[model samples]
Target: MPVYKAPVEDTLFVLKDVLGIEKFNNLPGFADATGDMVDAIVGEAAKLAEEVLFPVNLSGDQEGCTRHDDGSVTTPKGFKEAYQTYREGGWIGLSVPEEFGGQGLPYVLHTAVGEYMSSANMALTMYPGLTSGAIAAILVHGSDEQKSTYLPKMVEGTWTGTMNLTEPHCGTDLGMLRTKAAPQPDGSYKISGQKIFISAGEHDMSENIIHLVLARIEGAPEGTKGISLFIVPKFILNADGTPGTRNGVSCGAIEHKMGIHGNATCVLNYDEATGYLIGAENKGLAAMFVMMNEARLGVGLQGLAISETAYQNAANYARERIQGRALTGPKAPDKKADPIIVHADIRRALLQMRAINEAGRAFSLYSALQSDIAHRSADPAERQKADDILSIMTPVLKGVMTDRGFENAVAAQQVYGGHGYIEEHGMSQYVRDARIAMIYEGANGVQAMDLVGRKLAANGGRAVMAVFKEIGDFCEENRADERLAPFTKALKKGLNDLQAATMWFMQNAMAKPDNAGAGATDYMHLFGLVIQGYMWGRTVKAVHALQDAGDSRTEFLANKLVTARFFMERLMPETALRKARIETGCDTVMALDAAAF
Candidate 1:
């Protein structure tokens, strides 16, 4: 069985030292988010994940989600009670606004909590995770009345929320969606559509499910411009804020997939469902983005979470699994053989997983911090800068973190050899679960295009330059620090590669439009590796600072430095291969004609 010991100490170090959780506590509306409060919240969350959720992860995959003939979807056994515990614990709305029934924690802290939840049971966690995204959409674009009607209950976990964007015919290409919303006699509209791959679309976990759906309104233009967002509830609410009549929404069926089977993926049928319009009539796609971005980041955290979980299990296995004798001879000659961890290759695999997981954790936290800065900063310019950087980095976090996360899981599983492929081992679940994150929330390919084509070009490349400047400033400040020497060098090389890739794409995109599409994915990953290298470099510097101050966390800090070195030496060099591919141009990818193959 896969083991999961919560990395609580490392998480605390990142929150308290690296991201300044204390400083966040002083921010408006977060006065109660002290170190003690954070510790208590993280500790409780870890316990639930490790004890309750982790135990069910294997069974969840084994049993999967069940679709009944009555059209009701049933998650695996224990999911209901587990969800209730999550709700009662106030985890569902940890980062939501205080006006609602949420705890209103900062995103940075929420990111840490999310990592723990996901690490334990990513499939089960999706029920609440998707609800958080739905809540975000309603809060951002819904009318005040809508917010009053939905926010509190959703935050309280009496009800849950979901994003309904995909359809039977349309997945990523929302422009082709045929879902329609027609005006009714009352203020609400009638929605008719068939949405597929809807995560948590229908479940027994909560009393009500509020779906943020996208459909074309009557007389709207063709394509994406004509699409709008609507609020479709599974059950209509009464004047007393209780579920009244059953809405027209129903789950046609549920999908049996490769992983995340603990979370229902429903085929929803909205046959003249009672719906309320959010934002303008034809601006639904834009409104849905608010939720999509949040979901994207959450998915990225899923990637990081599963990787960390896999690493923990694999590392523990390596320490105990006795195999062949070591190259230098068996350390336990009296025993049968040496542990697998005694071998250099096994050590390398474990280190690879550790380095990526640690860096990914820090990167996800940094993105969350930027989100807080964008939302809570006092100055307009500061907020704008935060927004710019966030817009650029969001895709990177989603695309790179998830891609690397899957790789890390595979590596960790590799450490187990034949046992990794066995169902009973539970290590393969990490790989299976991590795989979807890359394809969902906009495929990694789409993310790369957005990064290189749109975000990089935003404000004439100011966003990209700002990120580069921040890294440059950090290097200048820490150049003299002996502990940061290797990290700094790796970061600088990564930056150079990022800039060169950017220039190459921009210069060739006009001449060959396909060039951007062809090279976007590889380039996005290259950029992410470089950015993560910078984050690891900064982490090493921070750890060294803590050590110099005679802090008791020297061992922890030293481990972080060593992990940073591991990342620089083993992981970051993959960018060279990616850069070479990007430089090779679109000829290799697009060389063949339509019928050539």
Candidate 2:
């Protein structure tokens, strides 16, 4: 069975040391988010995750979710109750606006909570995870009436939300989606479409399901420019803010997926459903991005969460699973064999997971901090800069963290050897569960394209240059820190490599579009690794500073330094390979004829 102990100490290090949660407490609406309150919140969330949710993780996978013929869905046993517990505990509104019955906590702290929830049970967590994204969208783009109608219910967990963008023939190509929405005399539109791969689309965990759907208005221009967003509820709300009659929405079927079985992936059919327009007509794609950006970050946290959980399980197993004698010699002569952790190779795997997980945690928190800055900054320039950096980092977090996260899961499973392959051991599930993170919420490939093709070139490359400057300043600040000297040097080298790769793409993209396409994925990973290296260095500096000040948890702070070194030595080296591939240009990728293979 899978066992999860929340890494609360490490979480605090990232929050207080790396991202400065103390400063966040001084922000508007965050006066109550003091250190003690933050700790209490995380403590409760961890307890719920480990005690309430972790126990059912394996069972959820085994039972999966069931779909009824009447178009309703049933989550695994204990999921409904677990969701209720999550709501009653105020977890659902951790970072929501205060006007909507939320605690209004900073996202930096909520990032830790998100990681814990996902680690406990990603499958069940998706139900609320997606709801959070939907609620965030309405909070940002929905009209006041729309917000009044949905945000409270969503924040209260009485009504959950789903995002419907994918169709049978369209995955990443939203421009090709065929869903249609027609304006009616009542001002509300009538929506008709079939959407696939809708997570939490028809779950029984909430009283109402609100779907933020993308469709093209009638007589609108073709392709993406004509697309519009609509709010389609499973059941319409009455005058008193309660679910009234059933809407013309039904689940046709559910997909049998590789993982996240506790959450339903439904094929939803909307037939003349009453839909309210969100934002302006012909601007649906832009509106959907509000939710997408939030979901992308959440998905990134999914990556970090799974990696942390997998590493803990693997580390615990390593210490207890005694096998061969130590390579240096028999260290446990009285026992049958020494623990696997004594082996250098086993240590390598564990250390790699540790380094990546720690760095990933810091990176996610840093990104969340940027989000808070973008949302709450008093200065327009500060907010714009934050938004630019956040936009560029979002794809990196989603793509690289998830890809590395899946790798860490595989590494953790490898530590288990034969035992990892068996389902009953619960090690294999990590790998299975981690695989979908790469595919969903925009595939890592799509994320890479967005990074290199769109974000890097946006605002005439100002965004990319701004990010480079930030990294450069960090390197300069930490160049003198003896403990972080090596980390700073490695970060500088990685940043140079990223810049070189970007220049190569910028020069060649116009001549050969395939050059960008070919180099997009690897380049994204390269950029992510470099940024993560920078984050690790920052974390090391913060932790060392705290240690110098005679703080408690010196051992934990020391571990941060060690992990920073490990990440710089092991994980950051992958950037060299990616650079070589990007510098090779599009020759190999575009060389083959259509039918050559």
Candidate 3:
């Protein structure tokens, strides 16, 4: 069986040392997230992940989810029980507001521990993950009555939630959606439509499923402008706030997916279901995006989670699986042959995975901190800047992390050679699970287009420019420190490449839109390389600062320094290639005609 030990200490280092999360004590929840509290939370989360969730991962995947004749769904054995344990422990509402029966901790804390839970069991994690996103949308856009009716129970985890946006015909284009809502005399609406690929759509794990569905109100404008969001419950609530009448929604079928089988990806059919509108009429897309953006960030973290788990198993296998002798000599004379880890090639693969996972973790947490600041900071200027940074990081994080995440999972599998392909060893599961993150929560391609087409130019490019300045300032500030010179030097080069790519889009994409479309993916990656490099630079400074303060764990610090160096030396340079691809523009990409095939 695959084993996972959550990197609790490493997470602490990021939260406490690198990001200095305590400095934000003026923010609502930061004061409560003291060193001791943060440590205790993550440490407990590790126990739940390693001991509880991980033990059921392979079994959950193998058994999958089952749908009954009555439209009730049964998750794999132990899933319901595990979910109950998770709910009882209040894991679902770690960062939800106190008003809604949550702990009201900083969002970053929730994000930090989220990595562990996801790495342990991505499928199981989705159940609550989707709920968190729904809660966010409702919190932001729902009316007071809506919040009172839904937020508390959803936050408490008794009623899980799911986002229903994709219809049978529409995946990325909400304009093409046909789900319709008709107004009722009692201030409600009747929703009739079909939503496809709904994760956590229906299950026995929770009492009720709160689906945030996107539908067009009757007589509304056509396309996306007409779309409105609604709260379509599986079981209608009575006057006493208990589940009363059975609503007209049901799970029609379960999708036989490539991975995350434990999640009940469903075809949900709504036959004039009683619905309550969220936000204003014809503004559902804007409201649902509140959830979509949150889901996108969560999906990005899934990339890191899967990559981390895959790397752990692969590294362990490399240390034990005897294969070829090292080219240098027999490092293990007693063995039949030296372990695979003794070979430079295996070491290279392991280091790459390690470098990306660590930096990716830091990148994710840092972005989450920005979110906390954006939402909680006192000063308007500070909030705007932090929100800008968060906005800029969102697409890059989702696009680049999952893209690299899938690649790294494949790389990890390659390290295990043939054993990785077999199911028993469990590497294949990681690869399979990692695959979906790139495709869902707005496919990475769409994420890339969003970055270049919309995000880059939002508010006249304020967000992107602000990010560039932050990276540039970091590079300029640290380039002179001989100890930090290598990191800053490489990061500077990457920043330059990223800036040049942005300029390329400005100069070329406006005239020829396809130029942006052709090179958007590369530009997204270029931006990712720089941001992760910036993370490493910040990590190195923190490590050095800790060392100067007489902190122990010399070995751990040394390894971090080595990994950070590897990132700068090996991974950061990829920015140049991405920039080159972007500069090549749309000619060859768009030159092919419809008849070419």
Q: How many residue pairs clash in each candidate?
A: 1, 0, 0
Candidate 1: tens digits of C-alpha lDDT, residues 1-597: 777877898888777777676776546545777778889988988898898888888888888888788788888988888888888988888888888987777878888888988999999999888888999888889899999999999998999999999987888889898998999878889999899999998888889999999999988999999999999999998989899999999988888788888889889999999999999988999999999999999999999999999998898889999999999987889889899999999999888888888878888988888898889878789888989888999999999989989998999889999999998899878889999999999999899989877998889999998998998888878788766778887888888888888889888887887888888889988988988888788687778778889998767777887788888988888888888888888888988888998
Model 1: lDDT of residue 327: 96
Return the top candidate by TM-score: 3
Instruction: State TM-scores per candidate.
Output: 0.98, 0.98, 0.99
Candidate 3, which ten residues in sequence have the lowest lDDT sum? Answer: 471-480
lDDT of each: 0.88, 0.89, 0.93
| Superior by lDDT: candidate 2 or candidate 3 | 3
RMSD of 2: 1.3
- How would you encode candidate 3's per-residue C-alpha lDDT over 1-597 as one tens digit per residue? 688999998999989988999899999999999999999999999999998899999999999999999988999999998888888989888999898999999999999989999999999999999999999999999999999999899988999999998887899998999998999999999999999999999999988889999999999999889999999998999998988899999999999999999999999999999999999999999999999999999999999999999999989999999998999999999989999999998999999999989999999999999999999989999999999999989999998889889999999999989888999988889999999999998999999999999999999999998998998998888777899888898899899899888998999999899999999999998999889999999999999998999889799999999999888888888998999999999999988897995
- What is candidate 2's lDDT per residue for 144-179, written digit by digit as tens? 999988998899898999999999999999999998
In lDDT terms, how accurate is model 2? 0.89
Evaluated at residue 136, the lDDT of candidate 1 is 88
Preferred candidate (TM-score higher): 1 or 3: 3
